[model samples]
Target chain A: MARGHPAGPTGPAIRRAFDLLDLFTTARPRLTLSQLARHGGVPLSTAHRLVAELVRWGALERDPDGSYHIGLRLWELGALAPRGQGLREIALPFLEDLSQISRENVQLAVREGAELVFVERIAGTGAVPVFTRVGGRFALTATGVGLVLLAHAPTEIQDDVLGGRIERYTERTVTDPARLRRMLADVRTNGFSISDRQVTTDSLSVGAPIHDHLGQVVAAVSLVVRHGTASPHTLAPLVRTSARAISHALARRR
Target chain B: MARGHPAGPTGPAIRRAFDLLDLFTTARPRLTLSQLARHGGVPLSTAHRLVAELVRWGALERDPDGSYHIGLRLWELGALAPRGQGLREIALPFLEDLSQISRENVQLAVREGAELVFVERIAGTGAVPVFTRVGGRFALTATGVGLVLLAHAPTEIQDDVLGGRIERYTERTVTDPARLRRMLADVRTNGFSISDRQVTTDSLSVGAPIHDHLGQVVAAVSLVVRHGTASPHTLAPLVRTSARAISHALARRR
Candidate 1:
C-alpha cells in the first residue's frame, strides 16, 4: 500500500514492475504500451523501460502488433505453485471420474486468504452452465466450494468475511451472518456443503473438504448440477468419496 | 545476460528477485530463504527483504513449514497467457475427444524461442507412458508437436535450433542437420509430423498445427500411442481433424 515511499524496503522499481504485471488479466491479456502506462500509473518512458526489461526477462512477451501479453515463462513459474498446478495435477483423475459419473460441472478450489480461487473445473456436456473460470476468484460466502473452504478457514479469516457485507448473487443466497454461521456449523457436522442455487439461479453444488497428510483441510471439491436434476444427498456422497480419494493420493504422493 | 551491473536500467534487485522465483521448479517447488539466497546469488539480508516484499505482494507464498513457493496470484496471471491456459482451455474439448476415441495420450505445445513448451497434455489410460508434462519444456526435435512447431517457426529460430547441438533421446531422434531439415520440410508438405520412437523407444506421436484467425500456426496438437500398435498413417487424419476443429473454435471464439 506504500505509494512512492523512497524509504521502504520494498523497492519502488520492483513495486512498479508488479504494478505492470498486475494490469494483465483474463479480460485484458493484451495491452499496448500506452495502455500499460495509463493503467499502471507510470509515465510512458517508465512503462517503456519496464516493459523492455520484462520482455528481456521473458515475463511479458511482445507480439508482432507491438502489444504485450503474459508470457509462457510466467506460466511456467506458476506451474510450480503447490496449490495451483501441483494440486490440480494430483486431483485431476478423481475430478474426471466425478464429472463422468455425474455428468455435471466438477470443480476444485482452495482458499486464498478470505477469498477462494478455482484451481480446476470440468464441465459436463448438457449440464447447466456455471460461470466458473479456472484460476479465477470468487467470494467465500456463495458457492459450495467457497462455503466449505470458508467453513474450515481460520477464525480470523472467517470473522473478517462474516463481519463484512456478503454479496448475494441470487435470491436463494444466504447473506445473514447468523444464519450463515449456522450453515458453517452444519457443514462441519454433515461433512459436506450443499449450496442450493446460491451462486446461480439454476445450479446447485455439493462440496466436500479434501484433507492433507496432517488431516488439515487443504482444498475443497464440488459438483454442480441442475437444481432439479440431481439430489444433493446423492451428489454429496460422490463428491466426498472423490475428495477423499484425492486427499489420499496427495498424501501418498508426498 | 545483464548479470550484476548496478547502473543498468533494469534494476539488479528486481533481476535478483526473478532469479529467486526461477529457482522453483517441478522438481523443487519449495525452498527456504537460505536456499533462495544461495541460488539467487544475493546476500541473505537482500534475499530476505525481497522475499518479504514478494510474499506481501502475493507473488510468493510462505507455507506453514516456512518454505516459499509460487503463489496463487501467479497462477491467476498465468491463466491469462494465451499460449498457456488460454490455448489449453480452448483446445481441451478437442483434446478430450481425441483421448476418448483413440484412448491415447493427447498433447498441445507451442514454440518458445528454439525450444518447446507443452501447454497441455492428457494421458490416455493404459496407453503409452509419456514424459511430457503440462507447462513443462522439451526439446523441439524429439516430439511430434515439437517438430510441427519447429517446422512452422521462423527461419532464424529453425537455423538457431539446427545449428545448436540436438540432444538425442532415442536412436530415432533426428540429430543430423540435413536429415532434420528434410524432416521439417516433410512436415510442412504433409500437413503433419510423425515422431517415430523419437522421444521414447516405446512411444510414437503424430502432430498437426492449429492456426489462429490470421492463418498463422499458433500451436500444435498431437496424439501419442504405443509404437507398433497403431500406425501414424491412421492417427494422422484424426489428429489433423481435431487440430482443425480447435483452430476453427479459436477463430470463432474471438
Candidate 2:
C-alpha cells in the first residue's frame, strides 16, 4: 500500500518481468540492465529492482561482464515440460537409431498453434546442413515435420496457417493454399509427408506423425537428407517406422 | 484505489508465483489447481487467478486431464540460458564424438552453488546405466564431474561442500573429508578427476574441466563405463581431450 516502494498491481509487475525475459532470444541472449529496461519499456529503477528479484529467485543470472541471461534454474524447470524434454527424451533413442542407420539429420517436433516447435534433432555424419535448432520455432508450411503437424492439426489451425502469409524459404516452397491443401490430403492418405527442397535448395525431408495413446497426432518425426542422396519414397517408411516406435514408447509410458 | 481486487504487494505475488512453479519438480511435474494451492500455501482463489495469468502468458499449460504442466514457452526461454543449453550446444558435437569413441555414457555439467547440474548427456550403447538426467542436480563430491567442478570452484564453495553432510550412494563412496580433499588436490594437479564407483558400484567415471577464454573452469565433461571393463588412465586422456575441444570451441565462439 506504500507509495514509491516498487509496489503496484501484481499483474503488471509479473507481465513486465516476463517481458524482460522475452527480450532474450537466440540472436541476443545477453543484455545489459539498461538495454533490458529500454527494451522492456520500464524505468531503470524499476528494472533494477525486478532484475534483482529475478536473480534472487534464479530466474535470471548476472554474468561476470555485468550482462543478464536466462538462468540454469529456468532450464531445470523447463526440462519438466511434457511437450518439450519429456517428448524428446522418449523419442531420442529411436531417433538416434534412425540417424545411425540413415546417416542423416533426424528431428522431432510438435505443433504449437499455427507454428511448430522442434523438440530434438540428431545430426548424422556428413548430413545436409539444416538451419533448424532445438527449441526453435518454424512456420507450419515449410519443413517436413511442420507439414505433418499441420496436416493433422485442427481445421481452424490449418485454415489459420494457410490463410496467413506463408514464408517462402526456397523457390520450391509451396505457398499456394490449393496446392498445399492437396499436399495435406496426400500426407493424410499416405500417412507421410515429403518436403522437397521446401525449406532449403539442396535438402529434402520426409516426415510422419506420432500418435499418442488416444491416437491423436501429438507430434511428428522427420529425416532430412541431401536432395539427390535419397529418394523420398524410400525414406518415408523409415521415418514412419521411427515415428511409430516413438508413439508406442509414449503409449507404454502412460 | 480498488478493494477486493487481485492487487497486492508485487514482490510477494512475484515470489508466490515462482514458488508455485517450484512446487512442480521431476517427481511431480504436473499439479492440479487445488494441489498447487495446497502445496504453494496460497488461497484457492488466489491460486486460480495466478494460474490463469500464468497460462495466458504461456508459462503453464492445462492438460486434458486438468493438470497444469510447465509449458513449451518456458523451454524456449530456457534455451537461451548460457549455463544450460548455451554450453550444451557448443559441447554436444564433441560429447557425441566421445560417446561414439568410448561407447560409454558421456556427460556435461556445470557448478551451481554447492551442486553441479548436468547440462547434456549422450548415452552410449551397452554402457553401464548411470543415474544422471539433463538439467538434474547432483552432489559436488560424488561423480567425476562433481569432483572436477568442486576442485576448480572458489575456496568458500569447496569448504561449504566439504563441511556439509555428504551423501554416500554406495559402500565404495568416500565420505571422509580428508580423503576427498586429497582427491580434489589430485584433480587440480592432474588436469582430470576419476571416480571409482563413487556413485554406483558398477561404474567408474573420468572427468576433465572445460575452461573459457579467461582460463577459468566453466564446466566439466565426463565419461562413465562399467567397472573392470576399462582402465581409468586410458579413459582420462579421452575425456580430457574432449573437454579441451569443447573449451576451445567455446572460446572461439566469443
Candidate 3:
C-alpha cells in the first residue's frame, strides 16, 4: 500500500476516486471540475489530479465542453457484473415476451444488502409509469420484485430490513413488521408476490422468484400494470412463468 | 495525486485499480485474488490491499466461492455513462420498433476513440447469428454502425484508422485505405451505410446515423439480416427512418 501523502481530504486514493464517481447521479450526470470538487468534498487541486487520473484510465470522460461523465470503459467493466448486465442479457428475451404478451411493465431485480437493485426494466404498451429504473435501488419492504427478493433473502438481511425503518411509498404500503413477515411467508408458500398499490396508488405489480442452479433465489421478476386494469391474482401466473423460464436459463448457463 | 510510494509496478493507485478491473471481461467475469495478481501483474500483497479497497468502495464483490466479480455499484455508476446506457435508454423504443418491423437484428453503437462500442442489441425473429455483443468493441471500418460513425468522425481519427493495420474478418472485407475512404464518402453522400459480409460472410447490415441536438452524429443505429434475406436498398429507408426518430427523441430530450 502507498503509505505517503494522501491527495484528498482523508481517505486513500481509491476511496477518493470512488467518492468522486458517486457524485454523479441521474439528476447530475455531468459535472464540471469545480462541481466535482465541491460535491466530493475535496480540494480543487486534489480533485483535478484525481479526475485526470480517472480520465486517463477511462473511468471518467471529459466532454469537449469541459464537463465530465462516466466513461464507456467503466460501462464495459460493469457489464461483467453477474447480478446486473449478465443476468439481464440471459433474461431479456423472456422479459420481452412477457412485456409483449402482458402489455405491462416488466422488471428484474436482485437483493443487495438490505435493499434491492433493479437489473432490467422493459416498458410495455400502455405501461404505467414506474418509479423504478434500471440499476436504481429501492427498499426491500415495498414493490413486488423487492418483496419477492426480501422474502428469499437470508435471515440477517430479512431481519435488517424488517427490524429497521420501512419506507412507505403509499398509504397501502405495509409498514408493520408483523404484516410484512406474514407477506413474506405467503410469498414463499405461493411462490409469487403482489404489491397492490404499495408503491404507487395507481399501479399494481406481481412478482416471482428466480432460482439459481443451487436452488437459491438469486433474483426476482415482476410485471407492473395499472391498478384497475388488471388483477394481481390474474397476473401472478404470467409473471411466475417468465420467472421460471429465467431461472431455467440461469441454471443452464451455470 | 498521492505523491509517494506507488502501490504496484510504479503506477498510481487509480491506474492499478482500473488495470485490475480491466481484467474482468465476457469470458473471465470472475477471478480469484491470485488470478487478479497474475493478470494485473501486481504483487500478491499489493493485489490484496487494492482488492480490499475496491470491495470496500463497492467496485468489486467477493463471491461465496472465494472469487471476485464486478459489483452492482459499478453497474449503477456505468448507467450514468452518456455514451453507453444513457443513449440506450433513449433509443431503445425506436430500436424496438425497427426490430419489430424488420424481424431482424437491431443494434445501437457509438464511437469511442477509433473503435465503436455496441450500446444495445435486440435479437429479432429468426435473427441471423451475429458476433457482436452489447458493450463489446469492433473495428470502425467493418460493421454498419461503425461505418456510419467513422464517416462522420474527425479527419484525424479517419486518418489514424486508415493509416493503421486493418483486421479482416472475411475475404470481402474492405481493407485498402483508398477503398475504405471511398466507402466512407458514399456513406455520407447516401446518408446510410451497408456492410456486405464485411464482418461475417453470412450477414448484411444497413446503418444510419443518430444525430444529437447540435445535429452532429453522436451514435448509429443498424438493422442486420442474413445474407440474401433482405436487400440493403430495401432496408436502408427503414433504418434511416428509425435513426431519424431516435435523433428527434434525443433532440427533444435535450
Candidate 4:
C-alpha cells in the first residue's frame, strides 16, 4: 500500500526523505536506527523502512558497528554538482598554488541560499590551525569567504543575515549589523576582504570574489595565515589574482 | 494510484530511484528528461514523477539552460561519505606535500567494490596533464592506484578482472592477464606499484597503499610525472613515505 495520500503532491514525501538524509551531519556522522528515528521525527517502523531503502540504494551504509552513515554512492553523485565538485575541480590548481606558495590554509566556498558552504580547503603543513571543514557550513559575517559571499548576496538575503543573530566567533569578530554592512560594502568596492583574527584568535584571512561570466560573485577564495606574520594588504592581491583566474577559467567553460 | 508496482515490494521502487540517479556519470553530467527516462528504463510518466520528487528535494536541479543535473545538496550529503571525503581529508596534507615538493600530479584513490575511484587529485602547475578526474572511475588493472587496489582486492574480484576484457590505454598497458597477475604480486611484495606509461603516452605514476589501524589497505596514493624527467624508482620512496604518513594519521583516528 502507499505510505501516504495518493492524491496529494509528492513534495512532502520528497522533503521528508531529504530531512532524513540531513539528519546525518559532520557532528553526527553515524547514528543508530533509534537515533535516526528520533532525529528524523519519524515512527520507528517508518524510519526502519526508509533506512533500509536508503541503505539498499547505497545512499547510506551500515558500518561494522551497525550505525548508518552517508555512502560512497552519494558522494559519487555529489561529485556531479557543478557548484560543488565542478567549482572545486576548477579552483583546485589555483588554491594549491596559493597554499604552497604562502604556506597557509587556503579555502574555496560558495553561497548556498543563505549559508556559505566550504567547497574545498588546503591546509599548509605549518599553517595555524583554523576551524574550517570541507562541506561544512558557517555564518556569513566572520570568515573571509563569508564576507565576500555576504557582500555579493541579494538584498533580501543580506537583510536577513544582518537582521538575524550574528554569532560572535572571537573578540575581534564584527557582530554589529551596521558595521558588517559597511564592511560588506567595502569588500565590494575594494575587491577583497580581510577577516583579521575574526574567526579565531590566531588566524587572519584575506578573501576575494570569483565571478561568473555575468560578473556576479559566484564563489570566494581565501588565504588564511597565522596572524601578525603578514599584512592582509600583501595577501589581497594574491587572493584577488587567483579569484580572477578562476573567474576567467569559469567564463571560458561557458 | 501507486503505479504498476502498487502491490509489489517497495524495494524495487527504491532501487529504481537509485538506478535513475546512477544514470548521471562523469561522462554524462547533464541529461534531458527523455534521455533520463530512456536511460533509467522507466516509463515517461514514472520518470517524470520521480524526477519531480528528486528535484523538489534538491537531489537534482534544473540548470539555467533548463537541463537537469545533480544538485549541491547531493554533493553536501556525499561529502559525508567516509570512503570518499574522509580518506581525502586525511591524505590531503601528505598529498599536498608530495605535490609541492615534486611539483607533479598527486592523486589519492580508493577501490569501491571492484573499480578504482579517484578520491582526490592535485595537478601541479606546469606539470604534465594527466587523464584522471576526481570521482571518476578507472580500470583496476591499470594506473598506479589501480594496481595497489587490485593487488589488495579479494581473490574472486582479482580472478574476475583477470578473466574479463582488459582495455589497453597504451602499448605498455598490460592486457595479458598473466603479466598483470605477476605485476600485482610484485606490488604486494615491493610495497608499491609503478605504472610506466600505462594510462597515457608521456606520463608515469608510482603508487603506494595507505593502510589503516587494522593494517588493511584502505586507500592508495600516487604521483604522476612526465615519463622522461623522473624514474619511478626515485618517486617510489617519496610516495610510499607519504602513504605511510597518511596511514599513521588515519590509524590515530581509529
Best by lDDT: 3
Which pairs of residues have clashing backbones in candidate 2?
Answer: none
Per-candidate clashes come to: 0, 0, 0, 0
Q: List the per-model TM-score of the A chain.
A: 0.94, 0.94, 0.93, 0.93
Those runs of model 3 whose alpha carbons end farther than 4 Å from true positions after fitting are A1-9, A228-230, B1-9
Pairs of colliding residues, candidate 3: none
In model 2, chain B matches the true chain B with a TM-score of 0.94
DockQ leader? 3
What number of backbone clashes does candidate 1 have, counting pairs of residues 3 or more apart or in separate chains? 0
User: Candidate 2 at residue B9, lDDT?
Assistant: 48
Q: What CAPRI class is candidate 4?
A: medium
Query: Against the true structure, candidate 1 has what lDDT?
Result: 0.91
lDDT of each residue in B1-254, candidate 3, tens digit only: 76667534487898999999999988889999999999899989889999999999899999889999999999999999988998999999889889999999999999989999999999897899777889998899999999999999999999999999999999999999999999999999999999999989899999999999888999999999999998999999999999999999998986
Per-residue CA lDDT of model 2 for B93-160, tens digit only, reads: 89989999999999999999999999998889889887788989999899999999999999999888
* After superposition, candidate 1 runs with Cα above 4 Å error: A1-11, B1-11
Model 4 residue A215 distance off true place after TM-score fit, in angstroms: 2.5
Question: Model-by-model lDDT, in order?
Answer: 0.91, 0.92, 0.93, 0.88
Residue B176 in model 3: lDDT: 97
Q: Compute the lDDT of residue A156 as modeled in candidate 3.
A: 90
